[model samples]
Target: MPTLAHQQIHPHPHNKSAFAKHVILLLSTMMAGVLQASSATDQHYPIDVQSCDRIVTFDHAPKATVSNDVNLTEMMLALKLQDSMVGFTGVSGWKTLDPTLRNGIGELPELSPKYPSKEVLLGADADFYFAGWNYGMRVGGGVTPDTLDPLGIKVYELTESCIHIMDKPKVSMNDLYNDLLNLGRIFNVESRANTLVTGYKKELADFQAHLTPLPSPTKVFVYDSGEEQPFTSGRYGMPTALIEAAGGKNITDDVKKSWTQIGWESVIDRAPDVIIIVNYGDVTAQQKINFLRSNPAFSDIPAVKNNQFTVLEYVEATPGPRNIEAIKHLAKAFRAAL
Candidate 1:
């Protein structure tokens, strides 16, 4: 037997060919792995998402986008999909976000303080728009799904705002979860979405279990806006569901719409035991309270007289992950008021 060094240095002709074949086999195996990884990254294409009457198909995940309002923007950030976002707007309740979320959001570009104009949205060259009813695109604003779809852009509306168009009987947490799962499917993050939904469900169940139900549901009124005529959440809105889930009754439950403006007399006649003021826009919650306290019309109201008021941020009242927290907060307030 020859020494091992001599055999490798002075290999036979046949041995040389065999060594080359082995090298080629190794390279081929490595190439196959690279291809497999590329395929995995390309999976979940041609996904169809149903938004009300429209079935929008996404050939690939949106790379650039314009997201509107705190609700949709926060949802995208919670999914850890900030790279997909190009610009965002509507920062009404952004201060209430967790520090981590706030830091993540701070890195993104703020396209506008409010809803972006169609020109601004188009200028961003975004492929998708995440928004809600009247929060972003408005009728005749020239940025709707009909207008954007023709330009190769897709739009997804918040499910809570689509009850009227989708014929949903009432708002539920399922709507928020469905939207999260749908976005996950669209973005190929089903596992993350499932985990988030599971966590929220567990937390909500725990909150409900510990809640002490009132002898009678507290008659609650949701004050959103409109000083001339009070604008409140109706039976179809997320606020109504939150109120009911928190062991309180929404006085506007009879109104079959989302948010409606009713005369002051209706609110007076209803005589809500507790008032939930929505904090948003130019009108502060303190201003609303002052208005209620100073006005002779509201003097007779039990909530105003007894000072049973709970203030919820505009984002909390919307359909999002925060809704569960809103329920817990309201439930605590209801228990305290009793």
Candidate 2:
């Protein structure tokens, strides 16, 4: 065979025109993509969204926002909204900040180590507060919507926590998506938010598909904190949805509460095969595990007898980007029979 440099080669006239047309088509497609990307950031201004019972109107995108808690902050960071934020609150109070979260904040300060007081938020001059009831606010707490609105700070309540102040159905992953979608529209980053939500849904579905089916859905109990009475997640808590997604049942689902106390008798009656420990605060996870191990009351419980327990960090068990990975861990633990 002759080398190209030593041989004469000629393209047909139609072929040359076809190649030119292909180049023009490719360039036009590229230009269209560029225009679409730019348009994604365009805002109409004065958008209204129904968040829980409140009809929140955004005259303009908030310039200084503060997200409370580690998991909630992770959601904001996932959307790349860090530059628009003033800082965060509620991370250092109960749990230490891990390196991944610490670096995501970069130079941003932790405005308050615990639940920030209204004055702390005011001092930061935050124009928006990304928080939930009990996550960062109480039913009538000092840092609630009633207090923040007059201070010119817009509040978006986490959907899962809505059950605390209002009547709502059981928690689902859609609650997580709704939060991101609303935040996207509020920030004029709707395209980014939609893309992230879509990716998450697809990723979660894919994760569930690969999971080997157990003999049945594994029974799961979420042990948050308790010594005398157990404080745990119930029907409306994010863990209910997470446990269901991992092909397990949350034993506390019948309680009809979020993070609340339940009778120790109910826990013993349910007898979960697996116990998920939410690790945080002054009390160590091992200590909590040992408590269950040594207690004569729990001696007959299935999980206690088998010592089948998994630990999730405070952030992993809450609503955020980490939940999917947490589900994978849960599925493996739930289906360990294989």
Give all TM-scores, in the order shown: 0.87, 0.87
The deviation in Å at residue 141 for candidate 2 is: 1.5
lDDT string for model 2 (186-288, tens) is 9988899999999999999998888788878888889999899988999999898989999999998888898899889998998899999999999989999
Whole-model lDDT, candidate 1? 0.83
lDDT against the true structure, each candidate? 0.83, 0.90
**Candidate 2: Cα lDDT at 114:** 85
- lDDT per residue, candidate 1, 1-338, as tens digits? 88864675555787998888886998999999999877876776777898866788888889987788877888897788898988887664333444554686777877877677667777889888998677686756766888788777789887877754557757778888988988898777889999999999999999899878799999999998888999999988889989988999999998888878888898899999999999977788999999999999899999999999999988789877788899999999888887
> After aligning candidate 2 to the native by TM-score, how far in Å is the CA of 251 from where it should be?
0.8
Lowest lDDT 10-residue stretch of candidate 1:
92-101
